[model samples]
Target: MAHRAASGWPGVTAALAGRLAKLDLYHPRDLLLHLPLRYEDETRLTPIAAAQPGFAAQVEGEVAACEVSLRPRRQLVVRVRDASGTLVARWLHFYPAQQKLLASGRRVRLFGEVRAGFFGAEMVHPRVRAVSAEDGLPEALTPVYPTTAGVAQTTLRRLIDHALASQPLEDHLPDDLRRTLGLPAFADALRLLHHPPPDVPASVLEDRQHPAWRRIKFEELLAQQISLRRAYLARRAKTAPAMAGSGRLVRALVDALPFALTGAQRRAWAEISADLALPHPMQRLLMGDVGSGKTIVAALAMLQAVDAGWQAALMAPTEILAEQHWQKLAAWLAPLGLEVAWLSGSRAKRARAAELARLASGELRLVVGTHALIEDPVMLPRLGLAVVDEQHRFGVRQRLALREKGGAGAISPHLLMMSATPIPRTLAMSHYADLDVSVLDELPPGRSPVRTKLVSEARRDEVIARLRAACLAGRQAYWVCPLIEESETLQLQAAQKTYAALCEALPELRIGLLHGRLKAADKSATMAAFAAGELHLLVATTVIEVGVDVPNASLMVIEHAERFGLAQLHQLRGRVGRGSAESVCILLYAQPLSPAGRARLKVIYEHSDGFAIAREDLRIRGPGEFVGARQSGLPLLRYADLEADADLLEAARQVADTLLRDHPSAAAALMARWLGGREGLLRA
Candidate 1:
């Protein structure tokens, strides 16, 4: 029988039905399994006494005048006569109908805190509930959850209640890992995350001790490590001679460079050449900071594959990047008489067919493309080396799809994954223990260091004057807007409006605006103009956060820097500092930055090391990402941390290795129970 498809709801219909719909929401349970959007504390409630006059505070008060304000703004403002005074507590966003209940003249309980107002002490918006004034506020620790649209916080709270109540415990971790790591049982840990004890401070738990969050981080690191280990084991099991590239190719490529490759790049090339010498396929992660010459190192590696009489393939996460690689490879490798084919979903059917034919005939030595390269119709005759850029964007399934692309019974290709995320060594070693890692930590000689400054938005005129001077000096700059357009609520700059203003301010200067919502061809065209120095200034969103490179653009003025993540801000800052010219990064922010936001901005000004920034990001934001990094509904360990609990991560790694090492033994049950102890299912 055909399975019923989802009808605008996940879990309500069979997943098979989702094939016809463009829905990413799997189910509520699936969402719980998805990597956390982020982790926040539920223990933020404070006493009325500790609340500052301007801050939101939960206070006990008597009902006075519970009238709805119809004039200035639509809100339910109840005059709560507290011990201090008769305070006007406004439920700013609440519906107007709630005014009737407030006017009952009876004392009601409120959950929100008092916030300072322009006039005096007031809670601009509060959550109110009618309770006996004598009962006061609820005294239990609440679990604030990660939610989605149409999924109310209340609905999530209830679902969590049910999952905790009815789900049977299935052990997924091995006993050795469990015992050695000092980890609680999976079920117990979930309970701790969902129903933490009252003694645990929300701040502390949300900051560091929240089991759900920590466990999820640990599991993610573990999964990646496991995939890496599998690749390592597979490599070790294979025997192949590493290619010895004649100096002719390397020297020719070097001689043609715009600038000399950095010492770090030289070292990375040596490492890659050495790895190829071994009989086993090379499985290495080339980690570097943005604009750190990682692409050149990869090109050099692919050159070795050519020298070895093997075909190489480069896969990217986006078409723009794929085209970029294709152009770069054609310029460098074409001189060596190497053929490069570009494939993507956007390619004409006939063009893709021709590329596939060339690929299968072993005529096209290299093929760079997006996910289109993994389609079943595309075939590689002798694909020996595979290099994937921005490895994090691709999933295990996609990787496997590519690995299995050659005809049946073909030997697996050597894999080299590259990332510019600059994960620190200690964390990388633990998180990616299976793959050999090479770091390009050096910049080429004569490359100027980017002078970074954090300026408050109050000093706009000074910054604007500086920008005008820079432009007049014929130095191009990037003015990055965090938001694409203006909003009444936020005072941040918009790329379009800023572009218009800059054009008006300096009529002689050419300014271009680029954002995602614009046409793709237009974005590409604008970027090309910027690269060619046709535009003196490029006003853009974070869309150019990666792959769009302009070495001449030596300045980056990021507006509302406080609103972006540390990693994202670092990526933006990287857009400059690539060329030999002196560069400056001005992080402009509105006044009164939050304590955490200030600290984030400080981290950028104080340090330029991407790995250090990454560590700090992990510390500040934890292991999960903004979204879509990890698949939805993967049972994440919420109790243990791989970073904080390295000992636990190691223990888990050992247990997994030992069990897999002893497959087909009676101990399999115990190992399965340990690793899959509490997991209902894992979504790839």
Candidate 2:
């Protein structure tokens, strides 16, 4: 087949080409990949009398009468009659050209939702296409596409038809592979999914489980798997100075800690230690429950690097978290004579310069900072280990940049990405496929579980009384509102208003307000006051969800808790219960909760395990909304449903591995077809 110029197509004008460009469809191959959203069964026509009300119906009939009426707010009414009965197609707004097309005696096909109106069996503004005597009706379902504002469905279809007719598509899937999977050829699959033969059941096409769709989906999943595998290979190809440690610093730190390490913590630390000792830079993810002492494991890894005469740096997402880590690390390491330096956006210029200088000289054995550590000026010449805390908050590029901080020649800094949010096994396997994973599944000892309860807004007074009593008992509490300020769209309480209300309700107790809109200094002061037990109650927003760790704050009252995701609710609840004192998390939800909201609250209330909550979140909110997917830049799966296509995904992974091993060239072609320009980035 010879290719045809898209501009030479019957309906494709320069303007149409420009519009198609907006859709990123340039070459014939791009147009071929533009799969339809759905197909409408227009092959068989429904008689006017048999048309179901409020259901889409397609009918072909000769126009018996056509006229524009001014009485009913100026509508063009076309009456068409077939063998069964007559139906009226009404359009409230129409151009004079449309009236010329709708003249009487003209055969036309009408498709739209039929409804009972003043005129019985009427279709309001139905899709109207003229039918000629020589025109043959389509023998298969009509494809409905996602189009831009300027491009119409008919014009798009014509352009696609031209492209398909002229372009010769090469099937990239190996013949054996296709036969083993029971899949159609690449070109054949494209044609089947686009046109879809009349014999193909509508339900199968709708679910996108037809052989054609599955084949395309497998190709996509294979591309992703291939890219991830290539990334792992590429990173491993580079040389990294082996961080073999004498276990001196690690042993000393473990002995110095007040509490003994849990079995899970010890295992996770062992894994990290082993990875760091490898010749290749360690690309690993450390996931743990909210209070699961992942920090200790990270500390052990950093200390191991320091023991090997290499510098280590830890980067956090927020300045508060960076400062929090610095405070804890400085307190722990200062006594051991290991210098720790801090850098953040809020750090003074002089202090930041000093820290950078110290890092460059390798005088700073352990460095803690926010994104400032990744900036060009802040160089760590001997950086052997780079720890990214709350890894989900940073992008892929940021993580790679931190890895490039040190190591001469091709060597790169070892990376240990840490997250307090526990990820479900399914998500971890797919999203973190390229990296090794270590999970800290157990919490530290003496950390009691936070008792969760749901409270109603109707009992606001009782809740206020309880909070006041809790405060008066020499304990601190947190009142978390969903919004920083009053939102006109939402009826949830604002942090500012809630703070004022709490002050008035409990005049004897000290209260502080914290939200994102507050100045950095003010926010830090408020958090400091709350942490020092100066403020009995702290009214805040979700900003405190991750880093504001006050152990004395035993009671957490989350207002309008229904609006938060399961992970967020769990994190907010984690802020409390850090102390030995008994802690309670009170979820105050608005009445008449939606099904999803009710389910989220119930999951949070019943389950204390972050991993279980993560799985439940994956089930309720789905893959797209899952924290792992949203944060990890997981490739968008067009036909592969994360839940329904789990088995297919596994098969694709195996196939990808085999193809890459046996036929590298074929794997490359597959990656080119699916990943396009993104293939290079994945290699990076």
Candidate 3:
């Protein structure tokens, strides 16, 4: 016999179960939480003459005529008439059963939008059902649910209604708290949302301005806050090495640097230093805009760990970025008599084994590498700090794997995650509330601001001419493409084709091509050549989106710039403006831009500040995609609008603190009800 589903519902076959699983509906409780997308009003009918265009209405009428017409296309056209007026119903695609049901002389009730068509006022593909004069209308609006293929809206509504009837709906929050917040009971809210009364205004229900929506949004926000705050507390309870260095190495590195640390850098360094001194593990996020000098602060934190006789490792998302970090750190630390080891998948076998041996023996106190750092063969016996650059690119599991390499049995290493994409204030408060955040809001002195230019792809010749001129004047240029290979779906200019074209167009200049498909050695050589000014211009993909900086390269031409995100465009722009020369970043976009693409281009062109761009980006993409919430293993909000519901979020934050402190059981219950098994991912 086959096993019954966790939902304990009858008639759920293996095939039905598979289809339901696609919607994450495994248990009866899951069905209860599956809310409707929208509702259709069928409680009353309007006269055909009174129905307005561009609005949905329900009407009851007789089918005066019905026939299949092939004038413009094969379709089923029916003339529906009430006492007031006649309306045409056209179906470009129809079934035989539908035609028979909507035959002439049949009295039917239809619900759909009315519009002026060639024949007359019409509703294309209106839902029609045979009805008698005595047939009563629906008592409540019909619910339309979000579903997958093989599962119809009717199936979902039936299952949800069954779940609501069978399961007990109990309030998770305390009675006093619910009353104080001016919210209804949990059961009342769910019932009202699932089957709203006809008397309620559709606007309030659709826009989520109703009291029930408020309760649901608040509950979700409260659960998220509880999960994050509890994770924060749990991390503090863990033990870690107190890396309180004697200030010898930190002072030495700062004194030996060619440029002075800006005030923002100094403040960030101080915050990191304080965290390092604590006995508990430090989980801090260091955020800075492009060219804000976050790498140096990370370097100082690593030195503090090394000075305290502990190992430190830095993990980057890409080999290019990792190699860049290795080179810069190696150059700075080599003079101080400290060697930083490099690890990557492409490293030679003998060299990788040798480095692994050194790390295992605690002979190497500092190392920088890509995801290879998290492999089981690699070891950090005395690891005290692990810095992740472009932290958002790594998944939660990968980050945890690196932290687990501390090898200090029972003691975790300090984690310092750095992101060049500035997190908006609201986003930081909601998503990153678990960790301490330090922002580097200022750029270093003497660096020029890049001038942004929006150029249509129609002006490709002019851009190529400008690039040739810039390179001929002794300034290097970067030609960035969105893709490395041809894609049938997207007609983007590939890096290889662009490279060949540029070489042919400007025969006097030396141009190199770099992308993710290239061998590790080739990428490194190409980047080195560009840095050394051996190449006048370099064509690359987004592989150079983050690191691999060259002060001499001032002009950046991004082909198909509209395809990139706001943060990525800013980072690419940051590649320029690092030197004294006036840099220009030309964004080449194709014609016929979409509304979202147009908005993104406008934002990038108008603003140069990363924080302002980040806020706009959040507004455009919302919090989930902006922060990579799914990869970070955090549950995204389903009902709450982070921007519009900021007030409720604040209230939820305060309530989370109170519940965790005073009503621990209630907090646990709320988290269990909402997060279920997903809460464990937050420990990372």
Candidate 4:
């Protein structure tokens, strides 16, 4: 029976379809693209004497003896013999049917890794199938596919083979382009990948270095580039308010700053300003190292919107960071006769209502808050710009909701995303291709360099002593713990326990505690006390990893630092070193460090550059985890390795632009095949 690409298999039952859904196989076309994770060789057989231990080989023999042995455990043991020698096959866990299949005098073919067992050479739970002497060896290696729990490898292979036979495998790229790029034909590549010849070097295919693999990777990347580039073009076609604000507010804020803007900051602002003045909605990402003065640039951009008689809003991921931004922006703008409203979930009901009312009426042009800003009650009728701080901390839908707040009567607000975590180049090229990027590479003048030290848990006492010394000398310090509460499984230090211990260790110094569970009022009081120099030391969790900044706080001690990620460690260290005084970050790690833990700590200790540390983090954790692909709403590359296939990525990028401009139909077809309607998520 003929099966359509979207109709799925003809005889698949509901139960079978449910299992296929778990592997994301909804139609026949999906099975065609379900490439093998690895392949097993079964094209030839080896004699018992020629079989090598620790290597997988196919061997044929007749079962001389079969028995259920209970000596070591319940198992099925079968002894097979050939003209050359004898081999034993054992199954620790077996069924009655399997035992009958291996009955005495039956000819069988075994495929598995041979091992040196106590009795003799053995194969553990190998693929045992009854065969006749007339049966011939296969012509090609068998394909093994990634399958779900209910779906067996053999079942998947059968379904995919059927799809390959039924589905149309046509090349979308023009012939000249494919030949110029030295890529193989589309149909040939898929057929070869599914059933490779016996002579093919397994290493090249396994490592994805073969020509067929290249074609697959290139096509996958091309689809991604086309999706992002098309999203960019689609966004430009939409209309937005042209926020060409007079330079009055921008100049006043710039002149009022204590220090001049760095060259990198100036360049970033110029690019942003130019985008804001355009008729199309601006989607730009402002990336800077920790403590590189990103907030001021955001303030200037917001003022540009306000100067054009439009409302502006900023959203942060957490309450603490939002409050920090609100405080700073208020302090900077209040002196210039502008009122900034703060909105948060924990605010008093009456106060939140008042802010929401003002926002909806356009009386409040500038507001900063957490996710509460995106709630249904809050509205910004004339919002011309929306800025999201630490944008990766938010999910795609949250950011989209904030943008929709300004979508009134065919007018959409421009968006500016700010991230303290530096994105590596390869990631920026693939994941963030839809957004224009501006980087603030320079730190402001007078920012002291922070010295990082790695200390073993045995030296905890020394680190505490150093902390006490620094605090007694009128310098504040932060003690960062990994968990807010006790976790018996992790055994890491908790903030409350560390707070009580530090208070007992140093009675003369005033200390404070902060964590996420605390009430909003209490958290604010504790943070305020620490920032105002009322507390000499503060014990906190990773809640303070990003926005809490105090110049007087010149020392930081991170307990169980090995448990923290590279980006978190860097942000926590940035809390200090804001003042002229020399700052030092002490990483207190436990014993028996893992290899990955050691690598992370080493990267943080050796490099103070955020970009350099980010590159290393990408290498260690890969692009998906490093940038939070789920939060960004961008599908990751399934076949292409950003580092290994960078050349192919560049080639795909160039081809994507050409396809979009000259061959729009081909571009759309490619996106449909690979992305499968998931490209809509990139609109946000």
Candidate 5:
């Protein structure tokens, strides 16, 4: 049977249908799901005498006198009075129609901010509409929705009202489940949220903690939980060859390491090894702060795969990161008589061909490259394990492509993803519920902490002198410009200008410049020089934010640090302090910082813990942009607030698990309703 169209709703016209379609509201339920952004309390009007300044107020009164004044500026002034006192309302720019509407003795309703004036209480440019005594006021708070250019607020409200009256809503939550959770029925919650009671405080509505709001939030969260749970279950049903191997290569690599793995590393590795031993492919997230030794864990996993007589491939997001991995892995693996191949878009044709041949014939036990590894030309015949480092840089499709290289008719390769940014517990539970999580919470022994300081631009010369002093002492320094933006030419010019200034400022020292605009080989060569201590000061952009590691580099100066996000700054700081030397990251911010920027800088200056910084970043940037870097496959939330509703999210996760286990049919309804368009992505 064909589904009925929302246009069929009573009083909905073709033109209105087109507008509604833009918002993806094709069903009455969609309208119901479109919750209001805020509410206007018009239940009663405040008397002009009792109105307080700096507070938004609504008033109803009769217009006693009105006139247009043109002194200093053209203005419309009207005196309105009720049983109490009178207030003066003014509009700097007014239409002739407005003047006629506020004629003498006319009754009007006004809503706007109240301000103290020379004569009395005043309202400037207030929202005014003509009214009659017979016109009734709204008995409850009026909902204000998010609307597009074509749709008017009144039209949306009426349509929603029609939906509520005509469309039948069923409670999907079980009766006992609702009682257990202390949640109201779904329909009742929507009605209460859309048209809150007159007694409901605006603070309650704004906080979104009212019982009605909680009901809606929990429902939305449960829908997401169900989708993720289903995906997790489906992946387990697929075939994946187990790569449990003898501890030959792992033991060899462990023995080669100069330092011991932290306890957290050992526990995380045990979890990963157990997962790889399972019949299902491992889709695990390896999260840790910078310098937490996630790379070592990944290396161990790859060696284990090779030990099992299958090829392993590691994919990085950038060529710089890939080259670093290749260099590090090559030194370790070559001693064990294993051929580690390197592939990247920047590789010369001859080197590429040789690696390709070795990769096809399975001569190379391990290969590390950038996205170039997933190109159609590069083939991995006996691939058993795929590791994605800095996993946030790649999308889900790209990750899936690397895993697909395991080829058809063969078991998919076990996948392990590594991230340097620590994800908060709430985000991990909801967004990464599909993947098992293993956190490397402890930094390796002998790693020094990076001390962060916020400095004003006026101290640029002092900072430069410090850099020179550090270089003279045989330590290297990194001078990072802001990350390039939409205008590549302008961004490059800025970095080039900064590099030139630094060169002039320190004529005796060797300085190098690096950015995305440089050629692939040139970038590699430049980075190699810096890593080898050939360059005393390396000036670059955010391209150096990830995967650029140097132990001897103890000083970092970030220009315009206020322009960067907390997470990005944290990543950049992570670049230093990898060695035994104590490092200092000086944040150079411009003058007149925004409140948010100042807060971010202060937070970075005080806290070095990545998990705490991540939570603060989430609170500042919100959940939408926080997880954007990682194509974690988590859908955007509409009604749930990740920060404010953390407790509710936990409850919802439990409810989702229960529903899936006990009431499959009701769970299906909930998922279908909330995740209508994204259902296919959840399916394996």
Candidate 6:
């Protein structure tokens, strides 16, 4: 706790040495946002006679003897005497110096798994420690915190305790404000949330239902809404020339359409056209669940940009997707006399140089590539539109990186982002507040629903045999593996091993393997083979979840399906049923599935609605790992759950909108100061 120099932390300061401390908070906002992972209130003190396997209990015993061993791993065995008998206390993965402590013969508290050994009752590799008389952990319901490598749970608890006890408390609601809102002071609210008694007040326990919570939710929402409104209004000042699609470009493509554009596609088309008519740069999110035909929407958008006599670009996250998009668009658009170019890591140096020169010379109409598109050296003569696929994977930095490639010119190119992942309302406000959203909720008519079934590992072989039969009948199937490779410690399962076994079991069928480690060219090659009927069954990692279309692939066999998230499973299922085939998705799970996993499977089995799955996914998993911190770049909320504070978000948006509209300079000043910056200094 002593204030001193911390490595690479020059400006940071710490509390005094003797001060009770809060956990070394990783993210200041996280403390406020660190919603509970799970609450454990199942602990019960048990006598030595009643100690048994599969139970979490608190036990006190007299220290009888202590010894050390190093047979498997370094260990210290402490013999403790209970009322019924003596028990061996096992501790593993400790300092070698701890041997001196074992000889001291001191009583200690033990926690972890309790298993009956060959000779007697024992705690195998139990997490043990000396208990302090005034330890802060609750006797019945201790909260286990997440920590970094050097940070222990105990250390985190201490820091949190200090923060709770000594930090300057904010009375968010003063006496006057409290009376107006019928709310308690900020300190009281924090205490109520962090250390509530058993008989918690109804208001504190269910903040979602509380009037104060509604006020807060409104505050958050209003701020976001206001900010977006300001940006939107400012952008509206400029006018864009509408380049309506003429049959000159669409005639060849329309004639080539094997299938007519769905009604939903037409709606999306109209929406994009309206955005193009505006003078301002288009900043819109094309949100469509998997198989909702967003790709066609993008193609139409690109054609409009090309029609304006301005070059357009499409950026993808990986080479596989980039190439896939290039081929599909090229087949349709190129036949209409539109020139297209491809660039990625796999492209040869000379070929890349040619593409770059073409881009710089304004010869290429549309180009597709991975992060390679955003390379600083790349030149775009007149970039009219930039369409990003799987928009969630690319964050602010990646998008900014691409924007720079348009050059230090008079104006930045328009942006059209497409995402299959359906974000919930709460998340849309906090995460994508800047971008306007358009949802492709309707599917093309006559698209048959995919039949989904949940099968256990015991039936895995049967499922595989069924897939073999289907493939033999000249049908294609996807065999998805869980992990990239095997691990000795997971105790779970792996995909590569499964792939090898399936290859051996189905020798007559063409089997292909695809995972992350493979080079982009190789992965794309395998995928092309599967699409072209060279491979009947594909054994792959989750690399194909985003947008690898194979209409002939009528069966999706996702092994160890319980391990994947709901959104991901839906995307994989989408890879099939794209063609005229009546597709079936088989989810193979291991025995004794977790309740949460069961719920996930049940939702998918009973329904195939992507948006519903997404909402439930958000509700079940909370916010974390849903959009993911890395992808959304949203700060975790501790005291505020976006889900719980929807009203606050709406209110915050309104305030931001009004302030910015009426007084831009003043609003910017307030934002700069609030963000810890001098007025007119920070651009954002």
Lowest lDDT 10-residue stretch of candidate 4 = 484-493
Q: How many residue pairs clash in each candidate?
A: 29, 0, 0, 0, 0, 42
Q: Give the TM-score of candidate 5.
A: 0.93
What's each prediction's TM-score? 0.66, 0.93, 0.94, 0.97, 0.93, 0.72
How many steric clashes does model 4 contain?
0
Give the per-residue lDDT of model 4 (tens digit) for 245-359.
Answer: 8989999999998889999999999999999999999999999999999999999999999999999999998899999999999999987899999999999999999989999
Per-residue lDDT tens digits for candidate 5, residues 71-174, read: 76889999999999999999998899999999999999998899999888999999899999899888779888998878988889998988887777789899
RMSD of each: 8.7, 3.4, 2.8, 2.5, 2.8, 8.0
Worst 10 residues of 3 by lDDT: 483-492
Q: Provide the lDDT at 269 for model 2.
A: 85
> lDDT by residue for model 3 over 423-464, one digit each (tens)?
988778788889899999999998999999999999999999
Backbone clashes in candidate 1 total: 29
* lDDT (Cα atoms) of all candidates against the true structure: 0.68, 0.83, 0.91, 0.90, 0.87, 0.69
Candidate 1 regions with alpha-carbon error over 4 angstroms = 1-248, 255-260, 277-281, 344-356, 375-377, 425-430, 484-494, 517-525, 591-596, 626-628, 631-635, 654-671, 674-684
Worst lDDT window (10 residues) for model 5? Answer: 675-684
Ranking by lDDT: 3, 4, 5, 2, 6, 1
Candidate 5: deviation at residue 380, Å? 2.1
How much does candidate 1 score in TM-score? 0.66
* Model 2: ten consecutive residues of lowest lDDT: 484-493
Q: Compared with the true structure, what per-residue lDDT tens digits does model 2 show for residues 1-684?
A: 122235654556787777887776756666777889888888878989999998898998999999989984889999999999999999998999889989999999999999998878999999999997677778878998889989999888887888789877777778988898888898989998889877998789888888898888878888888888888988898777699889988888889999899999999888888888999888888998888887778888999999998889999998778878888888778777887898877777897888788888777778998888888998788888899999878876777788788845567888898887787776665666788899888888778789999999899899999998999999999988874234633423366677888888899999998776667678778888889989999887777888777888899999989988898899899998898999999999998999999999999988999989989998997776775444455555555766677777788779878888998998898776665554444412
Model 6 segments more than 4 A misplaced: 1-256, 484-496, 659-684
* lDDT assessment of candidate 4: 0.90
Q: Estimate the TM-score for candidate 6.
A: 0.72
lDDT of 6 at 473: 89
Better of 1 and 5 by TM-score: 5
Model 2 residue 292 CA deviation (Å) reads 1.0
